[model samples]
Each structure stands twice: as structure tokens, then as C-alpha cells.
Target: MPKRILMDHDGAIDDLLSQLLVLTMPDAELIGVTVTPADCYIEPALESTYKLLQLMGKEEIPLGRGDYYGINAFPSEWRARPEIINALPMLINLPKSPDPYAYPSAPELIIDRLSAAKEKVTVLMTGPCSNLVLALEKAPELKGKIDEIVWMAGAFRTTGNVQTYQHDGSAEWNVFWDPVSSQKLVSYELPLTLIPLDVTNHVPVTKQFLSTLATQIDYKLSNLTGQLWALTLDTIPSYHYTYFMWDILATSYLAMPDYFTTELVKANVSTRPPNAGQTYLDDQGYVVKIATDVNTGYFYDYLLSQFKQ
Candidate 1:
């Protein structure tokens, strides 16, 4: 049987690419998708998500929105991306479907899906853990319904992507968005697989890779993938930040686990200031599987193969 998957994401470019990866992969069935306002304005995020589903012909999948605001919101400039992506000709030209407010909110949808599942569900989280944390808090027993959570969060071994006030630059943006939620999530007994910056930092989106993808845009999904990442090309020359395959890499592990390496680590999140959202190694912390390294050439090859017609 194919893996039953529920995806939760903040509407970043890579997050959308990650969703496309699951939608196209042969070994996975996307049961549902939930969008949070972490890296996007929820309106365009939902609009783009609905449009992407239509573009991929996966419109039957349920959609949910998270209204919860993070403690430290993402930058306004970065948050504007969903609207831009949503307006692209490929997405905006598609006919709009009826609103996909499947449940009252994200947490409720999460509960309803897990409770109704016939087998364990793999929760793919590419953003903050707010919705899942809320659902599990309300229905703690739902823990048994989850197989494992593959999340693109944290920066256990290297520096984080967030360079903001009150932070010591040790936390990834997803965790830094809502440290308390991260704290609550790690406390759960469910298996957590973290694709932290420790590994993703090594896989920045290079111009060479994008040029190669340009040659393989034979399918609609491949074209869409290229267009999405092409938006980040201007930032490539900047030394401060470059687009990394953060969420897509996490999503890739679900289909091609052999291209990556993992380690069991005892970890915990700090909810206090200065170190808030920071994930640290602690003897008393929960044991979680962390992706520590990846075979970049093979991983890129696999990613390119998925989009081939």
C-alpha cells in the first residue's frame, strides 16, 4: 500500500515544491493539506494551494487553513511571495475552484483526518508545528495514529536562517516563528524526523541545477517547479542568504530515504527568550531521528527524475 500522507506547510516556494513532489510521487497518497500563515499571507497561500491542486488535478484532496499567528512573524518581504506566485500566469490562469475550507480550521481538520484514518499517517510538516501541536493537545490519543512526522525545522548543528531581534541566531525560521509550539511538539511521544539546517545548508539551490531543470520542463509539474524556484534567482548572488532546498529535501526523504543519512538524537527546544526556538542536544530531551547528511548529486538526480514526463 502507498503511504498515507497529510502535509502542513507555510506557503514558501520550496513548500509548494514539496507538495508537488508528494502529489507526483508514485508511492504516496496525499490525503490532505493544511496551510499556515507563517511564511505567507493566508489568503494568497490558500488561493495558490487551491490553484496548484487544480493544476495537478488533485483537487479532491481536502484543504485547511491555520489562523494562528506566530510569536515572531516572518519578514513582510518574504511573506509577500505567495501572492506573487499565485499571480503567475500558469496558476492565475487556471479556473478557481470553490473555497476549500474543509474544516473550521487546521487543527480540527488534523484531528478529523487522523481519527478517520484506517492506517498510520505520515505527517509532512514544512513549517511551524502550531496546527499539529494544537491537534495533539486536544486529542492526545491521536498520537497512536501517526507513523512519524517528517519536518523541515531546526538547525541543530549549524547556524540558523533567522537573523532577527532578541534571537541569538541559533534557531531556524520555522522554529523561531513559534518556539513554544516547537517546545510543545518535541514533548510528544510520536516519532519525529527532523530535516534541520544541519543537513539542508549543504544543498543550496544553485544556478547550475536550475539550468538543468530548464532543459527537462517537458511536463506541467516540471514547468511549474522551474517557474517557482526561478523567482529566487536574484537572491542567489547575495552572500547573506540564498534559496536552499529546505522543504523539498524533507519531502524527498519520504520517497528516497536511501539518498540521506540519519541519526538518533536526544533533543529539546528552548521556549525562553535569547534562546527561544533554539533546539539543543540534551540528555533528558526526547529522542528523535535527525537527517544529518545527504548525497547531493543523487538527491538532485532523484528530484529531477520526479518532475520528468
Candidate 2:
């Protein structure tokens, strides 16, 4: 039987790319797509996710909207991006309709599906871990049912996306967005695999790949990815046409584990405000397998082949 996978993302370009990768693979069954709050608000993120699923021809897969904002937090500047603002209403207005899939809540749906499945379900998270944390809180019994959680967050032994003014780039966005939840999750005694920025930064989508894919996958997901890729390039200036395949790499690990180098070590999350989003590796008595490096050439080639197909 194909592996059953539940993916949660924040509708960033990389997340969309990652979903596409999972949809194209024959060995994995994408059970659902949950929209978490990060990089964009939950409303628009849900809309984008709906559109992407339509493009992939998987409208039957259930769609769940997660927390609009982090637990015990307010909206931030990151959620106010023009692109995000414009995408909000598109959720309700998307032309292609979704199946009549319904669930009481994201957490409830997660537990229900996992409980029903005979095989262990893999939970792939690529955004702030608010939904999973809530699921664990509400239904503690479901913890044992989970197979493994493949996460794309944090910066281990490297500079983070959110740097302190005092010359230390220690904090990353996803964990920083919800420090309380991050700290809570790290304590869970489950099989966890972290694909941090250290590995993702090495695998970037090049101009050649993007240009080729734009013409191949003629769908809304591809168009949105192309637009976001263009915007990311404009901001960086140097590598204007390429983007770090952050979330894509995490999903790739699920579909094809042979494409990366992994290390087993103890990992923990920092709870203090000053040290939030910090992932400590080799911590005493805590063993976790974290990905440190990736095979970029193989990843790029595989991605290109997927789009070509």
C-alpha cells in the first residue's frame, strides 16, 4: 500500500512546490492539505491551498484551515503582504469546486483520520506548528498513532532568517511565530525528523528549472509559484530567478529518502524569548535525526523531470 501522508503548510511558494512534488509521486498518498498560519494569513493560505489542489486534480482530498494566528499572539507585518492580502477572497471565488469533504475541526479531523488508518500516518509540517500542537493538546491518545513528523523549520548551527541586531542570527520565522507551541512540541516523545535551513539553503530552484516548468505544468499552482519565485528574486537581486527549496526538500524526504544525508542527534527547542526558535543539536540524552546536507543536483533534476511529466 502507498504511504498515507498528511501535509500542513502556510501556502508559501515553497509549500506549493512541495505539495506538487507529493502529488506527482506514485508511492505516497496525500490524505489532506491543512493551511497553517505563517508567511500569510490562514484565509488566503486556505484559498491558495484550495486552488493548488484543484490544479493538481485532487479536489477530493480534504482541506482544513488552521489557526489564523499563532497561539496567544497578534497579527504581524509578515501577514500584511500585498500578495497575501490579494489572495484572501480567492478562496471563496475559485472556479473549480472542491468535494463535499467536511470535518468538525482540523485537530479532530487529524485524529479521526489517523485513528481509522491501519498503517501509521506520516505528518509533514512546513509552517508554524500550531495545528499539530493543538491536536496533541486536545487528543493526547492520538500521539502514539503518529508514525513520524517531518518538519521544515529552525536553523541548526547556522544563521536564521530572523537575525538579532546584536550580530547574532539565531531566530527563525516559524518557531519565532509561536515560541510557546514550539517549546511544547519539542517535548513530545515521538519520532521527529527536522530538515532545517542548513540543508534547504543548498537546494535552490534555478532560473532554467523555473522557466522550463512554467511552460510545462499549465495550472494555477505553477502560475502562483512562478509569480512568487519572481517576487523572491526581485528582493534578493543576486540570485533573482532562483529560490531555496525549503519546504520542497522536506516533502522530497518523504517521497525519496535516498536523496539526502541525515544525521541522528539530540535536538531541543529554546523557550526563552531571547533564545526563541533556536534548535540545539547534540543536546545530552536527546537523540533526533536531523538533515544537515542535501543532494541539490539530484533534487533539481528530479523536480525538472516531475514538471516535464
Candidate 3:
């Protein structure tokens, strides 16, 4: 039987790409897609998610929205950079289906689906930990029902993408968005795997790949992804079309572990105010494996194959 996977996305370009990758994988069944409060506000995030699902032809699968924002933390501008700003308006403008249905909250949907699955379910979180944290809080018993959680958060030993923050290198966006929730969730004894920026920074979306995809898949989803890549290129002039494939790498690991290099170390989140969301390899606390590197060649090849011939 195929593995059941749930994705908690923030509706960023990378998140949409990751969802498409997981849906296309032969060995994984994308059970659901949840929109978390990360890249933008919850409403826009949900709108983008709905558009992505419709474009991918997965409209029947439920799309749920997460918390509005991280608890107590001020919102940041990094969420609305040109890459996201350009893509979100396009997604919002996409025509919606005539029949609309209401879905349960992200946390509730997670519990309901996980409870009914015949086998263990893997929750792939590519955004903030707010939904997971809320689910755990409401249903603490879900601790055993879940098989594992693959998260794309933290910076590990690498310099963070957000350099303006004065905190340690380990404090990245996802965690920093809601450190209190992340700190609470990481303390749980459930099996977890964290794919940090250290690994994802190596897997970039190059100009060649984007151009190839644009030429191959003429659908709205591919076009949006391609446009996002162009925006990234414009924002970071020196990098060309190269942008971090952070979330996609995490999803890829679920179907193809051979494409990544991982380390099984005890990892924990620091909850202290200034240092919150900082993850470390500690020997004494609850242990979880974290991916430190990825096979860039394999990623490029697999992503290239996803486009139409």
C-alpha cells in the first residue's frame, strides 16, 4: 500500500512545488493539504492553497487553513517579498470552481484523517508548527497515532536566510514565526525529521530548469511556478533563477530517501524568547534525526522529469 502523507504548507512557490512533487510521486498518497499562517495572512494563504489544488486537479482533497499568525510575535516583511507578492495576486485572480465546500480546521482535519487511516500517517510540515502544535494540544493521544513528522524548518549549522535577525544561526523563519508553538511541539516524544536550510540551500531551482518547465508544461500551475522563479531571479540578481528548494526537498525525502544525506541526532528546540526556534544536536534530550545535506543532481533530475515531454 502507498504511504499516506499530509502537507501543511504556507502557500509559497516552494510549497506549491513540493505539493505537486508529492502528488506525482508513485509511492505516496497525498491525503490532504493544509494552509498554515506563514508566507502571508491566513485568508490569502488559503486562497492560494485552493488555487494550487484546483490547478493540480486535486480539488476533491480537503484544504484547511491554520492559525492567523504566530503567538505574540510581530509579523515580518520577509513573508511578502517580491517572489510571494507576485505569485499570490495571480493565485487569487484564478477562477474558482462553482461548488464550494467547507473543510474542518487544519488541526481537526489532521486528527480526523489520521484517526481513520488504516496504517500510520506521515505529516509533512513545510511551514510554521502552529497547526501541529494546536492538534497535539487538542488531542494529545495523537502522539501515538502519527507515524512521523517531516518538517522543513531551522537553519542547523548554516547561516539563516534572514540575516537581519540578531539571534543565533539556528533561528530560521518557520520557527521564528512561532517559536512558542515550535518549542512545544519539538518536546513531544514522537518520531520527527527536520530538513534544515543547510540541506535545502544546496538544492536550487536553476534558470535552465525553470525555462525547461515553462516550455514543457503550459498549465497555470507551471506558469505560476515559473513566474515565481523569475521574481526570485530579479530579487537576487547574482543568483539568476537559483532559489532554495527547501520545502520540495523535504517532500522528496518521503518518497526517495536515497536522494538525501541525513544524520540521526538528538535535536530539540529552544523556547527562550530571543533564542526561540533554535535547534541543536543534544545528547541528553529527546532524539530525532535531521537531514543535513541533499543530492542536488538527483533533485534536479527528478524535478526535470516532472515537466511534460
Candidate 4:
């Protein structure tokens, strides 16, 4: 039986790539998709998501949005970067598709899906935790309907990639962008698995990998992925060893968990300014499974073979 999945994301290039990964999998039934305004304005994020669904011929899947903003201790620092706004940072080319139908509020859609699915739904989070937080707020009992939350969040035991807060340098982009929601969601004693920067940073996107992925992207929907991969790889300076395809690492773990090692620990998100979104161990925290190490070789091997050849 196919695993029923409901995905929530903030529109970004890597987020799109993560969606494509699930689309390529035969045993994963994408129940729905919800977009958050974390990376860009909700309008652009919606359009990008609709376009991808149309392009991939998955237009029938329900769409939803997480509307209420999470508290960002530092709003100015939380704004989207140029690369993130453009989505495809290095290229001006963007494919077009028909406009999508109106989507319901994410919380409502989530509750409806939870009530309908016979099997507990696997909620995939490639962005901030806003959508899940809202749904849980609206229907706290829905937690029991969820199988697990596979999230690409937190920095954990490593240095963060972005400095959303002050000079603390302790937050990953997803958690930093919306610290309040992150903290709220993580504190819950729900079933959750976190793929933090500690493991993702270890497996970087290299030229050779992109080249191989290029050969597998013959479908029209995947052409944009191929182009973005090519352009991003081309734009990298010679000195760079690998580019971190952040969200995909979490999605990769979803597709293959045997390639990962995890630790069950209690952690919390810092909601204070100059230290927002810093995930750290605290007595007042939630205990969840967090990936600490990865088998990069097997992960790369599995991911490479998954490209539609």
C-alpha cells in the first residue's frame, strides 16, 4: 500500500526539488500540499506551488495555505534573500502553467484529511512548522491521526547556516524564520523525526551528481529541476566542494531511513530576539528522534538511482 503523505513547504528551489522527489516515488501517495509564507509573500509562494502541480499533472491534489504569521523576533532579518525570492537564483528562465484552483485554509484541509484517511497520515515538512502548528491548534486531537512528522528543521549540534538572530549564530533558516511556530510545534509530545543540519551539511550537491540527475530529467515537468541544478552547479565557485541542498536531505531521509542514524533527545526553540530559533537541549522540551549522522555514500547511491531513468 502507498504511504499517504501531506506536505507543507515554503516556496524555494530546494522545496520544489523535494516535492519532485515525492512525485517520482510510486509508493508515496501525495494526499495534499500546503504552502507557508515564510520564504516569500504568500502570493508568489502559492503561484509557484500551483505551477508545479499543474506542470506535474497532479492538479487534482488538494492545495491549502497556512495564513497566520508566526512570531519572528526579528522581522527585518527574517526577510527572504535575493536567491530565495528569485527561487531559481542563477537563471531568469521560469516555466509557465495554468493557474491553480482556490485552496482551502491549511488547518481545515488538514483536519478533513485526518478524518478521512484510514491510515494515519505522514506529514512532510520541508519548511517552517506553521501549518502543522495551526492545524494542531484548531484540532488538538488530530495529533493522534498523524503517523509521524518528518521535518527538515533545526541546527542541533552544529553551527547554523543563517544568522537570523544576532551574532549568536545558532539557528537554521527554517526554524529561525519562524521561531515561535517552531518552538510551539517542537514542544508537543507528538511523534516527530528531525533531520537537522548536523547530517544534511555532510551530504552536499556536487557537479557529478547534478550531471547524472540531468540525464534522468526527460519529462517536461522535471526540465526546470534539471535547468536549476545545472545553473546552480555552474554558478558555484571552483573552490566550493558541494552545495547544500538543504530540504532534499530531509526528503531523502523520508525516502530511505536506513541510511540515517538518530538520537532521541529533548530540545526546544529559542523565541527571544538575537537568539530566536536556536534549537537546544532544555529540561522543558520535547523528546523526539533527531538524525545525528548519515551514511552519505548509501544516501547518495539511493538518491541517484531514484531519478527517473
Candidate 5:
């Protein structure tokens, strides 16, 4: 039986890759997709998600949107760029029309589906924990309905990939964007698993990997994927580093769990200043699975082959 999965993202290359991978995976019944802001701001993230789902002809899958501080869009007063993009920051950009989104918000949609689902629903989180955190807090019943949440967050036993001063270079991009929510979400001790930076940092993308993947994928999606990355890399030079296989590694924990080794750690995100968004070992908190090592070569090979299928 195919796993019923819900994916919430902040719009990055790996987020897109993970989306396409799910769309293509026969074993994945993608129940819905929820968009937040980590890569692009809220509007573009929502826009590109709807567009991608349309392109794949999977419009039946729900796409959720919301308006939260930073989660809705970048903090307006921040000095740096207002948004980032793997598709957005390029595709006509985030428009202000109708607030550009779908109904009931992400958490509502996710809980609604989980409430109705006959089987456990797994949420692949490629962004902050705002959506799940809200769902958990608002609808206490959802905790029993969900299977484990496979998340692409945090950094354990390794240096995070952040470089910006706003993040204090101590945090990973996703967690730092909304640390308080992340910290709170993990505290619930819901069935959760994390594929943190310690493992994902090894799943890097390059021209060679794309070339190989394109050769194996459907011509149209291959072309679209290539063009998407081209547009992103052209606009953001720094993304070359940020644009690694962060989310896919998280998906691996769901689709091919054996490829990655994880640890159940009592960890939490530091919501405070210079260390905000940085993940730390917290023996005092609930234990969540944190991926520590991976079969890197197998992961890449499997993804390439899966695209071909």
C-alpha cells in the first residue's frame, strides 16, 4: 500500500526536487502539500507549489497557504533581500492579489485530512514547524491520527550551513527562520523523525547529478527541472551552497528508510539570539529521530533510478 504523505515546504531546490520525487513515486499517495517561507517568501512559495502540482497534473492534491510573521512572508523591515527562490524570486514573483492562497490554512488542511484518513499520514517537513505546531496546538485530536513526521530540520553533531549574520551563522536556514515554533513543535513529543544537516549536507547536487537525472526522467519534467534550477542559480549565487539535497534526504527517511541511520535524541532549537535556529542536544526534552549517517552513494543512485521509473 502506498503511504499517504503530506509535504510542507518553504520553497527551495531540494523542496522542489522532493515535490517532484513524490509526484513521481508510485508508493507515495501525496495527500496534500503545504507551503511556508524558507527559500522564497510565502506568496511565491504558494504560487510555485500550485504551478508545479498543475504541471504534474496532480491538482487533486491539496496545497495549503497561510499568513504568519516570516512564515507568511519575510520580515518586511529586514535589510537583506526580501525573499529567495529556486523558482520564485524569478517566476513573476510573489503577487499581492487575493493574498494568493487556498482555504482553511495549512494546519487546518493537514488535520482535516488526517482526521478523515483511514491510515496514518506522514508529513515531510522541508520548512519550519509552524504548520504542524499549529495543528498540534489547535486540534489536539490530530496527534493520534498522524504517523511519524519526517522532517528536514536541525543540525546535530556538525556545523550548520548558515552564513548570514541575521542567523548568527550558528543556525540552519529552516530552523532559524522560525525557531520558537520549531522548539515548541518538538516539545510535543509527537511521533517525529528528523533528517538533520549532519546527514543532508552529504547529499549535494551538481550539474553532473542533474544531467544524469534528466537523462532518466520524463522529458517534460526533466526540462522543467533543469530550467527551474537554471533560473535559481542565475539569480542567487549564494544558493549554490544552500541548494543541496536537504529535503530529499528527509524523504529518504520515509521512502527508503534503510539508507539513512538515525538517532533518537532529546533535542531542541534555540529560539534566542546569536544562536537562534541552531539545534542542540537537550536530554531534558522529548526524543526525536535525528539522522546521523547515510549510505550517500546509494541515496543518489536510488533517486536517479526512481526518477527513471
Candidate 6:
């Protein structure tokens, strides 16, 4: 049987790419998608997601809009990317207009879908844990229905990507957006596979790969995927070092676990001070399956193949 998967994202460029990745997984069925407002403004994110689904003929899949707000939000400039994605010709050309907010919000949607599911669902979260945490709170029994949570969060060994005010740059943006929520989710009993910056740092976006992808615009998927990355080119200096495959790496781990190395670790997220959202090994921390490394060459090959397919 194909694996039943549900996804939650914060609507970053990579997070949008990760959603496309989920659709291409041969052995998995994406049952639903929920958008957290952490890294994006809600409306444009939902509209862009809906447009993507429509373009791929996956519009029937349910979408949940997140109403929950995080403690520390992302920068306004970064949050504005979804609006640009929404305006893309590939996405905006779609027929149906998107309803930004679905009937059930994110937390409620999680409970509704999990309750109705026949098999255990793998929850792929590429953003903050706010919606999932709330869902677990409302229906603690939902934990039993979850096969595993493959999340793109935290940084155990390397420095984090967040360089904001009052932070020591020890936390990843997802966890740093809401450390308390992240900490709460870790305390749950559900199985979690954490793909942190420690491993994602190895999968930086390269000019060579972009050039190769640019030559394959005949495939609509590849073209759309390329356009998404193209938007980042001018703004991000030196993409090779500045940006890594963050959320997409986590999404890839679900479809191709053999391409990566993992280890069990007891870890906890700090919720206070300059070190807030920092993940550290603690005696009392929860045990999580942490991805330590990835086979970069094979990963790029697989990624290209998926886009072309």
C-alpha cells in the first residue's frame, strides 16, 4: 500500500518546492496540506498553494489554512515572497480562483483528516509546529494515528540561519519563529524524524544545477520549479553558499530514506533568552531520529528526475 502522507508548510520558496516533491513521490499519497503563517503572510501563501495544486491537477487534495500566529515572526521582506510566487504566469494562469482560508483551520483539519484515515499518516512539516501542537492538544489520541512526523526544523551541531534581533544565531528560522511551540511538540510521544541544518548545509543550491534545469524547460514541472528558484537568484548573493536545500531535503528523506544517514538522539529546544530555539543534547530530552548526512550527488540526480517526470 502507498504511504498516506499529510503536509504542513510555512510557504517559503523551498517549502513550495517541497509540496511539489510530495506530489511526485511514487510510493506516497498526499492526503492533505496545511499552511502555517510563520514564514508567510496567510492570503498569498494559500493562493499560491492553491494555484500550484491546480496547475498539477491535484486540486482535489484538501488544504488547511493556519490561523495560529507564532511568537517571533519572520522578517517582512522574507514573508513577501509568496505574493511574488502567486503572481507567476504558470500559477496565475490557472482557471479557478483560490479561497485563501478553507472551512476548518489547520489544527481542526489535522484532527479531521487523521480521524478519518484508515492507515497511519506520515505528517511532513516544513515549518513551525504551531498547528500540529494545537491538533495534538485538542485530540491527544491523534498521536497514535501518526506513523511519523518528518520535520525540517532545528540545528543540533551547526549554527542556525536566524540572525535576528535578540538572537545568538543558534536557532533555525522554523524553530526560532516559535521556540515554545517547538518545545511543546518535542514533548509529545509521536515518532519524529528531524532533518536539521546540520545535514541540509551540505545540499546547497548550485549554479551548475540551475543551468542544467534551465535547459529542460520543456517539462512544465521543471520549468515551474526552475522559475521558483529563479526568483531567488538576484536577491540571494552566492546561492552556492547562502542557500541550502532546507525543506526539500526533509521532503526527500520521506521518499528516499536510503539516501541519507540517521541516528537516534535525545534533544531539547531552548525556549529562552539569546539562545532561544537552540537544540541541544539533554539527558531529559526526547529521543528523535536525526538525519546526519545526505548523498549530495544522488540527491540532485533524484531531484532533477522528479522535476522532469
Stretches of candidate 6 above 4 Å error?
235-241
lDDT tens digits by residue: candidate 1, 155-232: 888888878788788889899899999988988847999999999988988889888999988776678789998997
Candidate 4 lDDT by residue in tens digits, 1-309 = 898999998766677678878887778999998877776556666666766666567877888876767655323322333244345522234554234345688878888888888998999999888888888998898898999999999888888766432548878878887788888888786889999998888877777777776667774434566665554453334363245777888887777888789999889889876777888877778898899888888877766666553
lDDT of 3 by residue, 1-309 (tens): 888888898866577668767777778888887877676555555655666667667878877767457743424443544236425655656676332235568888877877778788899998888988788798888778788899998877876654334565457778877887877777786788889987888877677777777775565556666666666554434543246778888888897788778887776777765566777667786677788877787777776665332
In angstroms, give how far residue 229 of model 2 lies from its true place.
2.7
- Segments of candidate 1 deviating more than 4 angstroms: 100-103, 235-237
Query: Candidate 1's error at 182, in angstroms?
Result: 0.6
Which 10-residue window of candidate 5 scores lowest in summed lDDT? Answer: 77-86
- Residue 165's lDDT within candidate 5 is 53
Each model's C-alpha lDDT?
0.88, 0.71, 0.72, 0.75, 0.72, 0.88
lDDT of 1: 0.88
User: Candidate 5 has which clashing residue pairs, if any?
Assistant: none
lDDT for predicted candidate 3 compared with the true structure: 0.72
The root-mean-square deviation over C-alpha atoms between each candidate and the true structure, in angstroms, is 1.5, 3.9, 3.4, 4.0, 4.1, 1.5
* lDDT: worst 10-residue window of model 1: 95-104
Kindly report which residue stretches of model 3 are placed more than 4 angstroms away from their true locations once superposed. Answer: 72-94, 97-103, 164-166, 215-224, 234-242
How many Å off is the CA of 137 in candidate 3? Answer: 1.6
Give the higher-TM-score candidate: 4 or 6: 6
- In the range 35-64, model 2's lDDT, one tens digit per residue, is 776766655556566666776678788877
Q: After superposition, how far is residue 295 of candidate 3 from its true place, in Å?
A: 1.4
- Candidates 2 and 4: which is better by lDDT? 4
